[model samples]
Target: MKWDYLLFYRWLALNMVGFAILWVFHMNGMVEPVFLADSSYIVYVIAGLFLYGMVLCGFRVWKTSRELNWVKRGDKGKLKEFADKSRQSDRESVKEAFEIKLFARISFVKYISSSLVMLGLLGTVIGFIMVLTNIPANAVGDAAQVGKLVGALTNGMGVALYTTLVGAITNLWLNANYNMLRTGVVNLIAAILESADPQ
Candidate 1:
């Protein structure tokens, strides 16, 4: 498959399919929404951040794909243009662009992966705090009252669990994309070097 094709669109479809199905289940009441919005809407905020991270990664991928196309064309003149490090005056700098778009930042994939986990952990801790604050359910007052408390606690735990699951799955999803992106980048670099010095 072409790197340009897979770099942005295919994985976007995968994510849409995967997450849409999960959302359908959630909408149908087969699964919970992670946040009731009454207690803590932070889950939604984290999710939004995650989506933004994906966009950043997507931008980086799109930029890299452009460079990959340049490499595949095997344009010696362009390579010379780009490879010249000590250009006295040039507006478009290849080294600078490469560093920004490909090499250094990881497309924000690593950050998203780590941040997803942290967000999940934070949600879980908040859930635990919810349970802790309502600990009077275990105080052994009335049997019916205790049963209701247990149910409430169970629901709280469900929120924590679902958030954790979502975070993990999101990381896995992005990670798969990251691997493909890295492979494409490495290939592009090798192809550019080869094209630059065709022996």
Candidate 2:
């Protein structure tokens, strides 16, 4: 079967385009407010985690593509080394081990992706707590305190909404990259196993 060895590179290019568009939106002041309004700073944390995930995804893609190329050129690369060192003649066991090795490399990306959403939830809880704790007992009767109370409520709401939005969006973005990298890994494993097969 013919394989597009450039698959991972193409996927990485798509991710870069998506990020470029996001950067354009950010530069035009479209997304800046949502980011800035989150006083809890959870949005910033989410962004950082997303960046880290992207880096890991890129690295995985590069490595997988290189290994696939090596296999395509009849090098067998790590698969050959593993089969030789382990002295395992069962193709199934070797395939399973190779799959595990590939997946293990990017496990941290999965964890970081999950943590993004959880942190957003943490921000939301903090926001609600801020809202509840800032309300003065006399807010209903005291006009002067009412203004301050309303301001506090708005701030809390901003934090809640902004963090949730950032978290969901970043998670989706990172997941897309993860899925692409995963597909590459699957293809790489298939290629390796096929090459290793004895005719």
Candidate 3:
């Protein structure tokens, strides 16, 4: 019956600390410029998705923590309901039911984490397309168009590099959160099963 019920809270604290550090870098003009340079806006989309995933993780963590507390308090919570209903079932069945219930919503975080990387790759393709399209066929003989061509090339490259960077960093960030939530889910399942048996 001995379990670290504060696991989710500790993970949340770690997330907050990471965010604080990111904020510090952002305030010092280290992060905003990259986003501003990305005219394709794919980076923004990636950021939005990452935030959504974080919110999902946060909610799941909170709910899991509450359920753990309920189990600890011997209250008639979700785990109790599951235990009562699965009394006649085998241990494997009980474990399966607990996983299905706990992982139903939180699983979307994993999808979001994957999508972030894909979006970043999409941005890279778009940036390369922009670069190729901006090339003037006659720029070799046209001096006036060379400056514009260079500008366009730089813009496209910026978009490509920034989007890729944003996507990768956000994906890693979200996956970290997802992994923590997943670990919490596993712990919750163990606690529920142990409480059900107490042997």
Candidate 4:
């Protein structure tokens, strides 16, 4: 029934800071922006966002673990209550307690983790289109033009492979981190809820 007044603002601030750090890395050429497609840093930025979301997810897991540990030890001095204690204690309060945990609040990372893979697939499609639309017609003459056409085709292939690789690898890492955090948090919540009825 209650909420952290600055929860959204806190998440937004952390995300903005992460994005700024990524931009600095890109501007300084510490992190390559284009990968293999001279088009732009669109794919790379999406991957960075995925990375940031993973970090946020990890933080949520750590914070929730601490809170749950405190609760298990019968210490709730500063822990935020998800259910109103003044109300009669019941299973409902346990549900409310789970709702207020950091893991529950930051579950959006699950979506972000999946979206990174989709963005990578999108890049692959774009690269294939570039290759198809730029294909040069064969000519009995002008062997030089044929060589240039081959070069263009090769570059297109680079875009497709690079984007797919970035996406797939990043997705694997994000998914692993996200799932681990989800499972740990879920188990901890169940344990904490079962330990005592919040009153």
For each candidate in turn, the TM-score is: 0.75, 0.90, 0.90, 0.68
What is the lDDT for 109 in model 1?
81
Error of 4 at 7 (Å): 22
lDDT value, residue 122 of candidate 4: 78
lDDT of 3 by residue, 68-98 (tens): 7887777867777777778767767777866
Q: Give per-residue CA lDDT, model 1, range 112-142, as digits (tens).
A: 8778877777777877777777757445677
What is candidate 2's lDDT per residue for 140-186, written digit by digit as tens?
A: 79888989899889999889888887888787878787788888888
User: For each predicted model, how many residue pairs clash, with residues at least 3 apart or on different chains?
Assistant: 0, 0, 0, 0
In model 1, the runs with Cα more than 4 Å from the true position are 1-6, 23-28, 75-82, 86-101
TM-score-better candidate, 1 vs 4: 1
Segments in model 2 whose C-alpha atoms lie over 4 Å from true places: 1-5, 85-89
Q: How does residue 55 of candidate 1 score in lDDT? A: 78
Please state the error at residue 14 of candidate 1 in Å. Answer: 3.4
Q: Of models 1 and 2, which has the larger TM-score?
A: 2
* Overall local distance difference test of candidate 2: 0.81
- The clash tally of candidate 3 reads 0
